[model samples]
Target: MRTLIPTLLFFVLASHCHGQVERDKALHFLGGNLFGLAGAGIAKQASDGNRIWTFVGSVAGSTLIGLAKETVDAGQRENGWDNDDLAATVLGGVTIGVTIDLFSKKDDKRRLRGRYSKLDLKKKKQFLQPTSEFVVLEGKLPSLNTLGLSNQQFVVE
Candidate 1:
């Protein structure tokens, strides 16, 4: 009975809102990208630069924040829930998250000193020409291995 009243009220309030979902706003795009960048950065720092966790947390956090914004918007008569804004937020979050991960991986060799060495241009050309790709050998750090990426081959095109 207690739960039912709030649920009923929620529906009643929700039913009052009606608006065409707004998209293509500059503010939405900028806010989404910023949110995404912050989300990924925070997650990466908190997780100590673990790739998977950073990506997952970034996307999840951005999406949740977007939804929370929409929930508040839903009650506002001037602006209802905007699916398009949420989509933009999620996209921005994913784009920045993946980009950060890629950049981190590219720079990982420097961080994992002595495990992998620099490849000469000639040798690099040889490897590049044959397969049109080169693999990044992730070092066997105990923590990284726990993430299942240790010694994994990440192809660079």
Candidate 2:
């Protein structure tokens, strides 16, 4: 019974330590996400929506920060190195980039719709009207603008 008690105590202690380590890893991952998101936001504001600059700043900043953390942990000799943390940082940055791209696409669609809404029927027709130059279609080629069907539903073989 005495030996059993000691074994149980040891197991409980080990589980507690394991839980603490997992919690610490979670915190680090979340911290990386926040840092990467901030970097992305700052880059977007600074570069005025330039995708290349935003991506570079966000991913590089987060990755560098993660590497720095690993370096510090290495010096401490306790946590050693964690590749998962670095991967999480990169994933966070990519998430931000994808989010920004989605927003940009949404804005583009809105602007296009608004522009089209402002145009009258005559203007809409005029916009799709092709030039007077006629070209002969000898081959079975699909041409959307050839039959005044630009932006309209048409079948293509």
Candidate 3:
């Protein structure tokens, strides 16, 4: 629900730039989205799920790619650089980055809540306790006697 507004706003701004529609801007926008997604994935893996790095990586990647494309276009004789194209690319990046950051933050909050909710000793003990399932055949498993179950009552299979 929170993401819908920003997404709609991005499209509205992108479509209505300078009161004219530019078909070339769509390619730039799609390119930015692709690069931004790649950057977000790389950042998430490198930063161990850090939201800041993920957001930064996404925006930076898109902006940098857009800048590079504009620079190249400026050097050409027939094809010139367009700010609107670059803006569209950057907007795409911002949209993706914001969405990723929002989702990641929600996940972080959920994890935090889960951690705090497991503060009870009984709950912790139950969570940490091993169940009566064993697959190892060569090594000795932890004693079940300490858990109030006799060794004879335990089955190897």
Quote each prediction's TM-score.
0.49, 0.48, 0.55
| TM-score (C-alpha, index-matched) for candidate 1 | 0.49
Residue 16 error, candidate 3, Å: 8.7
- Model 2 clash count equals 0
lDDT of 1 by residue, 1-157 (tens): 9999999998887666423324454455556667776666666555555667767776877787788878998999998998887787777778767776666553453321121124322232533445554435585434545557764565456
Please list the C-alpha lDDT of all candidates, in the order they appear: 0.64, 0.64, 0.74
Higher-ranked by lDDT: 1 or 3: 3
What is candidate 2's TM-score against the reference?
0.48
Off by over 4 Å in 3: 1-20, 104-157
Best by TM-score: 3
What pairs collide in candidate 1?
none
Clashes of 3: 0
